[model samples]
Target chain A: MPSRQRLWPIHVILAVGAAAMVAPFLWQLITSLQTTGETTSVPPHFLPSWQWSNYSQVFHDTKFAQQFLNSVSQTVIRVLAQVLFCSMAAYAFARLRFPGRNALFMLMLAVLMVPSQVYLLPQYQLVQNMGLLNTLAGVVLPGLFSAFGTFMLRQFFMSLPNEVEEAARLDGAGTFRIFWSVMLPLAKPGLISMGVLTVLWSWNDLLWPLVVVNDDSKMPLTVGLSTLQGEHLTEYPLLMAGSLLASLPMILVFLAAQRRITEGIALTGTK
Target chain B: MFRKALVLAGVGALALAATGCSSSKSASSGQADSGPVTLTYGIWDAKQKPAMQEIADAFHTAHPNITIDIQLTPNADYWTKLQTAAASGTAPDVFWMNTPRVGLYAGQHQLLSLSDKPGFDNSPFPKALNDSYTLDGKQYGMPKDFDTVGLWFNKKLFDAAGVKYPTAGWTWQDVISAAQKLNDPSKGVWGIASPDWTQENLFNTMLQAGGQAITPDHKKSGFDDPKSLAGLQYALDFITKYHVSPTAQQMTDTQPDQLFASGKVAMFADGDYDMPEYKAAAGLDADVAPLPAGPDGKKATVINGLANVIYAKTKHPQAAWEFVQYLGSKEANEIQAKTGTVIPAYNGLSATWVASTPQYHLQSFIDQLDVAVPYPVSKNTAAWTTPMQTTLDQIWGGKVDLTTGAKQIAAQMNAELAKE
Candidate 1:
């Protein structure tokens, strides 16, 4: 091990890096408690005036509790659906000897290349036709499957040893049983990382919800927070308060899953 | 094998479902007038949403069977959502429309014509506003509100500098002399905040200089014209030659509006739309005056307005029209004026808006109406405006000379106009 004196430079560098990462959140916290006048002052106000009413003002203006529930439920559904569907499809591509498997995999990979905006209109129309606009089902349906999730898991599944699967088959286990009882347990890290990605994406989704959901009651937190913004003028203090309040749950979640997230990311080999 | 079959069946089922959706959509557009109607009204401003809701409630009182649902999308996503919704034939029954997009939406037949409707009168609004939504001799939008550029000054800053407040008929020379006096570098204060903005700054200057941004026919660019170049130079000289205004980089760091509100900028050219914010800002003593005249003693301001327009494929056209008509009525305009959210486009309502915020001379924006130029726009204004702004940024940054930049912009703008 290196001596403490020898490692001082690395520690200093890391401290600076950590501070840089944390500065924006600290600024956001300060701004959330400031008045509109204080927020826009030149040279900026490092110390807040502590106008806590800004948080109350956000709640008064928007349906905060309802949007919080909407965001949570939608994020949960999207994460589960992506994990369940992507894992199964990933397994099939990794293990099954299906016809035109290469072509199918290539086609799925092509989806990852195209931007999500390209699918927005067609997806919106499809949901509209299904009479699912402004409903939880409409928001979750498009997010249920993702090519990136499938591809990421497929790579993980392929890297697993074939001997373990052969051993399971020798005991007369079917493909479904082997995938559920044997392979799934081994692919836990891949599934966790994919689910984490899905959670982040669904939680932050603004455009699709803004398009599909017209009612304030049906909006997710992201869309509801956006309503606080105006065409020409926006109350930054109120917006920051709402954003800070909205991000609390996610921050707690990240703290709880910090170790698992890092471990999963490392095991999966790609973010 | 079973999973593969399930996937194939799923794909086939989705295709069949899509075809089924298309068939149902055709029947939706021809909805009956007898049923209870709910017209979705789309708007982007959160500050104005409450006033809009009040207007909607008043409409609902008159037409008990018709309900108005207001949809609020932030301005950033409003156009994107509108474009997508329009493409799918599921746009809002009525929505707010601006001058730049009126041409495209009307030309594409995505908007319903309000002129042909019975009892529809265009005389209640200014001609410049009416002409903004009229294309090819047909009116598609009912003017809701209008905004014009004005010289907003900080009274305290003017007094501190011993400069008299700018009044009506003040010329450009007066502005330059006052700015030179007011500028205080030690206090980190600029005489003015001059940003490279079109509606609020450049277009008004261009018109005041007896120059047009585009030809009357809207088939060519006027940016390369000598008069237009002079106008461009006039705005540029504030930063480079006069050095009384904040640099482009400084304005970017702290937006011009914020700088003005914080007393760091003595004067700013902005639209009346920003009055509500200025009223709410604490410790800022501000007032408005008409913009100074150009070299030849011509006073001009660029005027733009928002309109209430009905989507062409609305399920209940009659109900939508009734709501739209109510929105354009004197009562609705009064409500708008009382809220001070906007200067109502309805004739003679400027006094009502001015009284709503009595501290400032809101009438300055209204007084320029006589000389106000219609906001110059083409079928696809963004095609040229977007590029023109990019080059103007370079010019404002002192990377390009005004004459060369103006000619470059004119050439690009002409090409876009030709395409249109």
Candidate 2:
């Protein structure tokens, strides 16, 4: 067994780090239960009076259920698309013998260099021209492809043993068949990490949704919760309650995938 | 590192917002269209949203064929979205228009001219407010609600200091003396808090001194004028020279409203928009009085109001105009007033608003309306205001002489105004 004395310093450091991350969330939780008068008070209140009604108010007042569904739908569509399309593109860049392979791979990498914002307008225009504005499809389409996912998956596919693909080819299997059946199973960690990340990102996206979707009924949780903030006076209690409600699904997602997330980190050594 | 990534993302979003704007301009406006239209009415204030919803429901009750869908973008993102939408010629059919931006929007021909619309009236609201939306002698929107600056004070703090509450005719000298008597630093109490905000603090003082924010013709800034500089000095002295007010650093750490609510500050300059929040503050008794007269012996406060404007490119102009007419009508104003959400622009309804919340004498806001000067705006106010605000930040921080900062800001503003 490890000695308690030897673990003390490490324990203290981890505790401090954990508390630093958790304190803001705890404050949010406590603030969510306080009265607007109590929350906005000077010498800010630490203890919650446990007003259960703030949560109720969020449901009754705002379109919380509709927005929550929008967030879930958008995230689910984005994650599935990223895992499927990114893997297909990554496989082409990794093992397929196509002409101009180097040039195409280089072009894909160059896209990673350009900021994501450069595509916002053009993508928006494409969506607009397609007459998808203020629709669920508009929120999902731009998020369908991701450069980072392609790059990460391509590297992971490349890192896999070459012998497996050659053996599949020797068995008279086609390239697409080899990627789908043989190589994809080995690249699970990379796909899982990319999927996890895409879920987190698409769930929290605010600006793009606000730009394209003007209707509140169609907005995701991120954009919907923003309207809780007032012009001169923000009611912090209501804001916290709305945010807490919106973020609960994300928290559940992280918790359920906790072991896989850690495994992904171990294999990839990166987020 | 995370902050850098977020900044990069923000920059990307701004680029997207810009491109998103021009790409959609092809969705052009048409001549008066009608029938079963769903009018999207955008507003910024969530506090006033419920009242707006009530107004929308009432409009739907009358105009059975048209449906009013209320869209809310929080105040910060409201303008960015509006600007991009306006640029793309897809702005909401009718939206809340603020004073500073309406002029710019109107000048670009993005807003419909309300004067020509049938059954539209601007006569019920204050003329100063109506004139705020009028550009080149044509009204583009009908005024909704008006706000004027007043001195918000903590009665308990004044009582503890044995100082009398501020009265209607209080001058700058009276405020200064009272603040001096109320200051107690050892107790962590300040006589007053003077934040470097335009609407809440400095803008009213500038007007009280008979100064303007910009030239009437929108060609030049007034910061270089002697009267305007003096007005700015009066506001700055509360922090730089006097011991009565909290230092700039302290006010930055804590908002002036919080300072007052906490009992650390005895007084602050704010508008009636803050009334609900003040009423909600625990252990606080707050009331407002007219902004003190300036050294020039005239009391003027900035009178800015919200207006409802129709999108220039709207396919359903008739429905949008009908909604705007309903918004300006007395019934809607009364609903807005009864909520105590704002001082309704309609003259008689303001008394109902004053009576809506009687705990604090909100009548001070109404009394100041008589001497209310329109908040200064040029054809492109944001163009000049952005540069002036950046320069004024240094002056407010006491990093440069007020005069030098004023002149520098004036030069930048003049250069920008010349572009328009």
Candidate 3:
């Protein structure tokens, strides 16, 4: 155990830092319950007007329920695809003895270096050409494969002890068997880390969905909440309320899986 | 093998569903299909959304076979979304367009040519706006509404200082004299908020000084001209020399409108669009008046407006055109005008809009229309304007002299103009 007084100062510093991070979110919650006039008041009003109707207005003014469904379906499908596809690719690079394996892996690593915007047009074209525009699958298609996840999982797989793979090979286990059954169970932390990131990225993804879907029914929450923001003026109270409700699922997801998330974070420190 | 067959069946079903969707990709455009058709109309203004929705409902009642879906992507993201969607041929069937972006969109053939359409009419709109929307000899959009800049002052602050309310005949000299008396730092109030903006601030003043933002030819910038440099300086002098306006840093931290709403600024040079919002501001008493005359004894205001345009690649071009025509129709403008939502672009609808909000003397916007200068643009305004804005920012921050900054902008803008 550490000395109480020595650790006490460090604890105080961390607590303050934690509060700083939480303050904005707390302010968002308070602002969501405020009136339009109260929210914009100078010298800053701390107490809210308790205008709870702001939350109801978001539902009434926009197709928030449908958008919430779209976000969920897209994110779940995207996360499942990333986990399954990335783990397989990472396993192949880690354990397989295929021709051009090193070259293929390097090319994927290069994909991570170039900015994502460079591929936005081309990716959109490919999805559009597939006749998936305005469909839920269109938004999920591009996010399904991620180079960062493959690289992170590959590094984790490489760091694992070689004895397990050698033992499995001696028992005449095939590469698929080793990857899916033997090594996969051990890569749980890496998979969890990738899953958490994919969910976060896909849930909040706005630009791709905004471009792909024109109908209000198929839009994600980020795009739906955007309607509350107009050209000249915005109703801040309504926007804050819509966003708070839209962000609740993600917040709950992060809190419920926080311990596993922290442990997953430890395995592959890079996001 | 049985499980494999099941998996294959699932994949086959997905492929069929994809084909079903792709086949209907032309459904929004092609009248040959004869089924119920839906068209997407994209817009950016949140304040005008309810009225736009009402217009759409009215249109739907008349054209029962056609359904219009409204998509609002705030102005900030509207273009980026449009560009991406246009590249993939999935842009909204009809959308709102402004002057600067009109040239870019039309040049890329992203917008439909409205002139050749059967019922297309530009006679109702101002000739300047109609010509502004034309690019490469093709008219692209129909004007939806227009807005002009005005001097919006806090009546309470004017009364507190025992100063007379601004009249239409007021000059720039009158503004400086009144601002000096109204500026009270001890009470956290500034006389004006003169942020370095093109539309509502510097550009209009430049025209008042007999200077154009870009030459009529659109091949070069007019900022390097002596008269234009003086116009830019006059707006900046309120902060640097007169000390009556908020500093550039403060204006950046707090928008001019926010300061005005809080009763911290006596005057803010804003557009006609903010009239409705000002009416809703609790404690602040505000009204509009024409911009003061410049040294040249001339008054000018920057006139800009949104237009309703159709995507060139829309599957339902005929339906989309009907909706666009209706949006610019007198009936649709009346619905928007009666609510004081916007100054309808139609010729005779201004009076109704003026009466809708009787409290504010919004006729100042109409009264200045004779002296309104068209919002400047070229085939690629962003290419020049983006850099021009940055160079102007340096002057605003006191890093460069106003004349030197304008010259720098002219050099960069001229180079960008040559490329187009």
Candidate 4:
């Protein structure tokens, strides 16, 4: 009886937290359907007539499909590259025995302490020197490697026992074989977590993409959405509708991966 | 060894895929494809795309050997993006420039000087408009258009209240009396929808009262001057003492423009750019008049203009300059005027612009240009405004008195100006 009573408060707290987190998205969805006059009405309208054509209008007004494709391509390539490269680097730092391995690991971790802006100007110059301005490669190259992912995976790998890898090595498996066949599958939680993070960051990145890409046709959804905001200043309904559409992909990703993400977070806590 | 080979193959495939995706098909506007030539024109407003395309078509007709690509970036992101492009030496060949940002770009030498460019003439532009874009006796941009602030009133509201419509030479006292007479609180209407604390909006009023926002040398604060303080107090009195304007909180909840559009306010003081929007949204007839004069009996309006600038590092300088010249010409101005997008800076184009939009009286904008003072600005305008606006907010919110706020802003402005 006492346990049941304690559980009720926990359930209530969770319900409230979920509602609070979801309210803004719901508001965005509702506001997107409103007319401009309805949006500015005094006391504010909570419900609005569904203007489904706004979804079609967003595509008609701007190069939404092209930008969406750009964002998807950039984000997918960036996330996949980060997962593979970071996992390998983390494997080397966690399991490999080599000269100055600890020092190299420390140097990699040191990069995470510096802010991102310090690298912006130099990185921009580097891209410019390479003649990659206004190109998708420039947007993806800077994010292809992530020190945070390396550090995260290294910590996760360090927490795992060596018995599983040793067994594979004892069976005549080489270092690469052990890492690829034995260890990576075991590091699924960490990889999943990092993959989600990489996807989220790359999908919503604005500043770096803004610097690299000049052509509107090459712009990602974030930059494209902002342009829509400025061009359609008085058309709040359309802006809101565009914003709602832009956020849908990220929301759907989170929803689909929520279970794995929660499990990863719980594992992270224990680690 | 096989696993390692597999990983290497994967990396190679990824690199190949990335390379394939990075390739962009370049679009050219001219017939010539032999030489190293690509002219990029940067514009801030997408609404002006049709006009820009027309200009580009005209330029292409004249010089078929040069390609011009119109690049549109919105206003808020334009400067930051341009700065990034400037730092990387890949900025568009030619771009739209604004007065507030001209000094910084010119001081940095990021803009191409246009004073000696062929087919360039400065005499057609008014002296007041031309002076804003000139830096150190060298011109970086041709004055493409001009704008001035004015009080836009709803004629239907005035007629309903039996109040006389404001004319060209109305005083601040006249405005206050008319506002008081027209005000009916119970009907959810106010006399004026005063802008919430913009130096651009308030400075003209202070200047009309024989005060300035900054010292003559642009090194000190003029906000602390008695006349400037009186102007601020008068703006505050509309909400506090007179109760003829919405409270600070109400203004915050809904912007003054939204309030005015909803017919809650009888008058709104803003630029001519809002004329089309007001006519479209506010279902009542509207008219414009010069900003009311203060006790000194001299009316002042803030004058600002936009320019087309060529980037310093453009690969096709000649072609870029041609496009810039075309955008600044009377032909492009006529297109803009007919669209009613803004009052074209060309001297005689106001007639066409005013005629294009009949719902609102746009002649007041042209008249105010005669007495309009340039917006007080410097290379470090943003730095000074940050602190000035914060202190002004406190005064408007009634948290501090006007004198104290003005003093604080003046001290802050001087410190910032010294840095500049």
Candidate 5:
């Protein structure tokens, strides 16, 4: 609402900040369209020569299509599973009165303190014992349940008015009915936020997928894109091109769900 | 970031080692009775995959019942994945092994000994390369390829400076003077790129100055030795005293190899593994010369090589051994040489590698074999090497003096080596 003349400094600062945020992405786009040599050339090549073949080279060298499909399926399964399972666990912890419930919730909360890497080997062995190595289920199973998600959703459920659940109960609804038809719909924002997080994490996870899956065809986009990297000499152009394509879907998803994510963050006070 | 992952993975490896997962139950034993055997050959370099595939195809042609499957894991995650798989007892049947890891794997009894295998001979490869894979007088790997350090200079930069090209017997003084002449700060061109690289820069100079990285017995740290400090000083002086090379910070921001490839660095000490990158670089006028001699009037280059090793628990040991033997054969070396992927470890085939790319005088790498020393290591090399690198980084950053940093490194390295 301030005058345009008086707001110039703030506008300039925001513009500068926005440019700083965008510079790396712009550089990536430029590099993606350059030749391998030009990417490493000194006096750095600012303008790209539009070497679009770098993108096609990614498909030729790796099972990009299969991996993309793998990533999509794995992410979809992980988000759905985490939402369903975490919400169920969260709902019980939030409203239900059970024996030693506080102690049980505390035990679940303790898991959030430990680093995930400490669990990598044991989880791997479990998956291996179950004969799930190199399978999509192996990658998705460990990620399906997260302590952070349960805790976040639990807080959201607690913040909701107890009157709504009581009204559902008065209508002859039980705990399961109240959770399914009433509490879940009320906690939509928390679920949406948790779902977004799981999608991002599952899409970008490298170490677990790299460990569980050895076959390139079964690898997700993250692991498949890594094969384009060489030990001593990586073709930066190809890597950049492939990375751009790999990130495009996430960017599109973010755009499509932009309003919902911000609204979810506003309602749940979580990001 | 990769180094951080390596340290984490190293901890994971230690945990694995502590567990002592010695159950070598052949996971693939059931497949032994099957008709065709597909042995997985794990490798890290994507650039050499084609040549490896060619060798595998040729081996398959020879042995109709054996098929070799090449598994390419990029180097960054290779060791981590290998250790995880090893713990789970699903490691590849055969895989590429490097000098740093040979001792660790062999000591852990994870690698199969090739010494008593029929038709397995180390005579064709250099003794230094062969010795790298040997522990307790037992051969565990077949030498596949070797890479020696060379002084790669930008020809156009040398011409612009009106300096003569480096040759076979150039001394350290000659290198200093040439670097000084070629250094042009205004043009953003450095006389050299002297980053704290152990294999390419520091190790070569350390050896040239009559210093050993580790004792022959691999029981103590040699960084405390005065001769080794002298060699490191020679490389360190380039940045601190002469200012001919880029600052360590600059090199970190932009890798020294990238600097050299872009023609910003006049001279770079690197290995043949970098040749493909340089060859592919557009408008890069570069060629190699033997690294300069040290103050002791003797030349030395740290020679490192990769070897093909089979997993101890491989179900199809016979087929794996046959494939490994073929991989080490003259014919397979020729295919590798023709592709110019690496200097084939087999003696007398280096000429083919030198001739593979006629543009550069790669023979300089070959000629240095006479004075090449094996890359140094202990049972757990990374335990000491990682600390050595940290101290060197501080020294290069001008945060610590050479004497203090060297002594600190020596103390730490000795402590780690003693544990090993």
Candidate 6:
């Protein structure tokens, strides 16, 4: 009976947490369906006629599809680049013995402590000098390398058993060969987890894209949604519809990788 | 090792290819050898884009050698981007600037002086409008249009409630009495939209009450003065004491404009810029009247205008200045006025503007301009709004008494003024 009581408390806590997380999304869904008149009613109606045409209107009114494509391409490129570069750098710092590697790794980690806003102006200037302003490269290049990714992967790599690598080294394999053939395949969960995070961050980013891309045609989903919002200020249903579309891609990515992410977390804990 | 190197090389090659594709794409869009010089014109309002394009087309007919490119940044992001572009020396050749921001940009030497530009005949624009763009006796921008705040009321609501529509001669007490009689809470109808934090609308109210929003030299806050305090007290009492307007929390939840547009409120205070939106949303005819007089029997309103200026860093200053001058011409202002986008600053174009919107008494806006006071502003205006808004919020929220809130706002505004 005491065990049952303890289980009841756990269920109650989880139920509350789940409700808290879901309440906002449900509100957004309901708000997205409300007409302009119903949206600002004095009592604030919670449910109104489902204006499903709002989704169609958002697509028809703005360059929503093109912006969605831009966001997808930028996010895919950033995720792949971060995963490859961070893992390679993490392997070097964790396992390889090279001159000045420790100091260099520390310097890289120190960059993580500096706020990203501090580098905004200089980074923008650098992109301008390189003639990459108003281009997707400007958005993708600055975020390709992340110190947080390196540190996380480095710790994961370090916590791995040394016997497998030694055995691979004895089998006529060099540093790159072992890292690529034996270690990389085993680090799939970490890479997938990092890729999901990179995609999520890149997809929702606003300020940098707004600064770099001046043309509406070149803007990503986030900036495009903002412009759409400004143009259709009186149309709340359409704005909410566009917001729902923008969030769909990230939601799909999260669900698809949820299993791998949980497994990666469990593995890290065991280490 | 070779395989790893190949992968790294592949990634690097992909990045380089992507960069090349983007650069080549932009290059192909605008042919480099085209003899007609391409000039970029920046504006803040997308709603005004059609009128600007019309002006651009007309300018192109006269100066066939020049091509104008329209670039729009919204109002909130315009100044920040303009400052950055100015710092980088890549600002558009011609850009829309406002009175509040022109002083700072001009002081920094970032705007091309238009005082000597040909075709800039100031005789066509009102003196008050032209003076807004002039600083230290030198003009940096040319007046394009002017606007003022007024009471926009729903004629249908007034007819339904059996309340007579507000006239230009009404006083503040008249507005309150009518609001109290017309309010029907059970029917989701309110009498007014008492804006909580905006100083532009409230400044006119204060001035009508024989008060000032700031000192003459723009050094101190006038909110602590009895007249200013009384003005704010009257505004706050509409929501707190009389319950004619929505509470602060209700206004914060959804903007007052939304309430008015949805017909939940009978009246709202907004500028001419919102005229198109209200007409489109409300279905019924919405009319404008001069702001009511205060207890001091004075009627005041706030007047402001937008201007067209040339960037100092432009590669083609002469061509850009020509475009800017043309935008301020009667021809361009007529197009803007006809479109109901703004009230043209050109003296005779206001009648055409009034004719474009026949649903409302749009001429009342121009009539009120004679008594309109310019928005109280200084070089450090941005520094003053933050704290001033916060203290005013307390007054609107009924957390602090009107006198205390006024005193606190004055102290904060004075500190900000000292920093300048």
Question: For all the candidates, what are their Cα RMSDs to the real structure?
Answer: 6.6, 3.6, 7.8, 8.7, 2.1, 8.7
Residues A1-271 of candidate 6: C-alpha lDDT, one tens digit per residue: 5688679988999999999998987877887887765665555677768988888888886689899999999998988899999999999999999999989998998998897745655677788889998899988999898887788788878878899999998898989999999898888778887777677788998878876777778889887776643322346677688898899877887788888666655654521
Query: For model 2, what is the alpha-carbon lDDT of residue B57?
Result: 95
Q: Cα lDDT of all candidates, in order?
A: 0.86, 0.82, 0.83, 0.76, 0.88, 0.76
Highest lDDT among the candidates is held by which one? 5
lDDT of 2 by residue, B246-300 (tens): 7777777777778787778898998888888788888898788988998868998
Best by DockQ: 5
Chain B TM per candidate, please? Answer: 0.92, 0.92, 0.91, 0.88, 0.96, 0.88
Error of 1 at B278 (Å): 2.2
Query: How would you order the candidates by DockQ, starting with the best?
Result: 5, 2, 1, 3, 4, 6
* Lowest lDDT block of 10, candidate 1 chain B: B1-10
* Ordering by TM-score: 5, 1, 2, 3, 4, 6
For candidate 5, the TM-score of chain A alone relative to the native chain A: 0.94
Tens digits of lDDT, candidate 3, A37-110 = 66665657899979899999999988999999999999999999999999999988987889999999999999
Q: Write the per-residue lDDT of candidate 5 for residues B10-90, one digit (tens) a residue.
A: 575585687587656445532443588889999988889999999999999999899888888888888878888887777
Top candidate when judged by TM-score against the true structure: 5
Residue B211's lDDT in candidate 1: 94
In the range B95-201, model 3's lDDT, one tens digit per residue, is 99888777766766677788878878888887677878888788999899998999999999999989899989988888888899999999998988898888889
Note the residue pairs that clash in candidate 4.
Answer: none
TM-scores, each model vs. reference: 0.95, 0.93, 0.93, 0.89, 0.96, 0.86
TM-score of 5: 0.96
**Per-residue lDDT for A205-230 in model 5, tens only?**
99999989888899999998898888
Flag regions of model 3 displaced more than 4 Å.
Answer: B1-36
Question: Candidate 6 residues B1-420, lDDT tens each?
Answer: 111122232232222233331111111211233467889888766567778889899999998999988776654455545554565566788888776567666756677777866556777877767776777777888888888888888887889888999998899988998888779999988999897645335787788888888875667878888998778878888898899999999988877877887787887877777776676562545788878988978888777788888877677777777777788787888888888878998888899999998888888788887787766766556556656766677878888877888888888788877976
Better of 1 and 4 by lDDT: 1
Task: After superposing candidate 2 on the true structure, give the runs of residues whose Cα lies further than 4 Å from its correct spot.
Answer: A1-6, A114-118, A262-271, B1-34
TM-score of chain B of 2: 0.92
Q: Which residue ranges in model 5 land beyond 4 Å of their true spot?
A: A1-7, A263-271, B1-9, B23-34
